[model samples]
Target: MKLGVVGLGSMGYGIAASLLRAGHEVCGADVNCEAVERLRTEGAMSEEIVTAAPDLHALVIVVLNSAQTESVLFSENGLAPKLTPGAVVICCVTVPPDFARAMAARCGAFGVHFLDAPISGGSVKAAQGKLSIMASGTAQAFEAARPMLDATAETVFKLGDSAGTGSAMKAVNQMLAGTHIAAMAEAITFGMTQGISPDTFLQVIPDCAGTSWMLENRAPHVVAGDYTPHSAVDIWPKDLGIVLDAARASKFSAPLTATALQQFIAASGMGLGREDDAAVTKVYARNAGLTLPGEE
Candidate 1:
């Protein structure tokens, strides 16, 4: 398959690598020249996406949000018009369902297939070609994207035969994931106030009924004092904001989601937006005047 990945961030780079390993002809593009060069060294094509657009069988978008995704596909010099008529645009960004539907419609007008395919399982899983994709699209779009999907995803949930369902499902996922990470931060820091060290909390939580995938995955970062972002703090404010917006549109009550969004916003306000999301623990730490593991 001839594929192009438009964002070379952690998750995007991983997806590009997985496609290359699957023996696809993969070209990568990013605003970060270094990320493009890094993937080039790993057997991705060095050609810019514009140059490669005509021959691309599928273009996978792993950009940050709806706006970037829109710009990538439909901006003045967007790739959608440059693509071959039958080429598939596989959108892996978390976005509002309406945005996904609109993008799908626009792509259809260009005779391009649009797959509203939002992904999960993070960078490690993406690099291993083990990502879980929540995908919704026409059968033709799915067929057009199958080779790329086979290379990049371990599980593809065919959510519906339209564009919005996949993004809607991704919203549900982000609501829970962001909330869980916040809950994990709160619990770990709350334990610190009780003299239960972060280390001790990590040691016991996974074996307890209250533990979650977020706790097991993120608590270790807090314990090690490593804020290096596999997923950054800034992601939550946007993703959870999408969740809350969708919830409000449906008149849904989401008190916990609202609370979690505020904590992440506070974490961002404290200049922790670029840090590992586990660093939300720092917000609690500051509120309680408790020093975390690596703080002086």
Candidate 2:
């Protein structure tokens, strides 16, 4: 299959690599020329995404937010219009449910199929082609997208036969994921104040009842004091903000989510926006006058 992938960041690049390994002809685009070039060396198509759009059987959008997703599909010279009738747009970006529904309607007008398919399992799983996709769309959309889906996902949950359901599920996921990461940072730093080293906290927690996937996954970064971003601190603000907005719309109280958002905001304010999200511990450390591993 011929596919186009927009936004070749960590997860996007991994998805593109997986598609290439699956023997698909992949054309990748990114504002980062190096990412595009990097994927090209690994056998992705070198053609410009715009020039290749007309022939693409599917397009996977892994951009950061809904705005970029909209621009990719609906902006002037957007790829949606350029795609042949019956092509599928697999949107992996997390977005509002209403916005997903709206984009589906707009794409339908152009005779394109839109799948609200937000993904999880992070960059590692994406590169391994083991991602979990929470997807919803018309049956026809699923059929049109199956090839790329098979190439990219290990588990594909069919949520509903419409666009909004998938985004709704993604919102739920981000809410817990953001909250857990913040909670993990808080607990690890709080332990530090009691003279429990980050390394000791990591060693003991994963076996405990209180441990979570986020805690196990991110705590190693804190222990090693490595802030290099596999996922950045700034992402939580936008993602958790999305969760809070959706919560507010439903009259849901998300105090934990709100508190987590503030911690990420403070981390961003401390010039750690581009650092690994585990660096949220720094916010707590600063408030308590404690130093993290590398800083010490």
Candidate 3:
């Protein structure tokens, strides 16, 4: 299949690389020219994407949010006008269900299949093709995107054959994912006040049920004191913001998710927004006057 992947941020870059490695004819675009050039060096041809857009079997959009996704698919230089009839559009942005439904309907009018496919397992898993994909769409969408899914995911849960369910499930996952990350930050720093070092906590916590998928994955970055972002601190504010927005739309009271959003907000206020999401712990660390690993 000829594949065009848009957005080469941490997650999107990994997805595009995984597709290339899977032997697809892939073209990549990113606002970061360096990322696009890197993909060019990896055997994806820039000339091919534009000239071949009409024959492209699938277009995988792994952008940060819905706006970017829409821009790539339907904006001025949008690929929707160029994509072949019956081609599939795979969306990997974290977005509201209504937005997902709207995108699906718009694509349907173009004789294109749209998949509401938001991803999980972060960048590491994305690079390794071990990420989990929560996906939903028409039967045609899934069929068209199957090869890409098989190449890029360890597990693909078909949540429903409609636009909204995948985004809904992604919202549920983000609610838990954001909450777990915040809880991990809190517990690790609280342990520090009691004399348990971040290193020691990393050594002990994974074996306990108090641990979570996020803790097991992100805690090591805290212990290593490497805040170089695999997932940036600012992503949570957007993702949890999506969760809270959807919650508001549904009149749902999500107290835990709300609290987690505040902690991430505090982390951003501390100027850690550009750092790794694990740096949320630093908010707690600073509040208690505690030193973390690699601190002065």
Clashes of each: 0, 0, 0
Point out the higher-scoring one by lDDT: 1 or 2.
1
Ten residues in a row with the worst lDDT in model 1?
287-296
* Residue lDDT tens for model 2, 118-222: 999988999999999999999999999998889889999999999999999998999999989999999998998898998999999999999999999999998
Number of the top-ranking candidate, with lDDT as the measure: 1
* Ranked by TM-score, top first: 1, 2, 3
Q: How accurate locally is residue 160 in candidate 3, as Cα lDDT from 0 to 100?
A: 95
Instruction: Please provide, for model 1 over 151-268, each residue's C-alpha lDDT reduced to its tens digit, 9 standing for 90 to 100.
Output: 8899999999999999999999999999999999999989988989999999999999999999999999999999999999999999999999999999999999999999999999
Give me candidate 2's TM-score against the actual structure. 0.99
lDDT of each: 0.94, 0.93, 0.90
lDDT: which is higher, 2 or 3? 2
| RMSD each, Å | 0.7, 0.7, 1.2
lDDT of 1 at 78: 95
> Can you write out model 3's per-residue Cα lDDT over 1-296, one digit (the tens) per residue?
88888888889888988998899988888889999999899888776455677978999888888888888888888898899989999999999899999999998889999999999988888989888999999999999999899889999999998998999999999999899999999999999889898889989999988999899998998888889998988888899998999999989999999999999999999899999999999998898998888886
Inter-residue clash pairs, candidate 1:
none
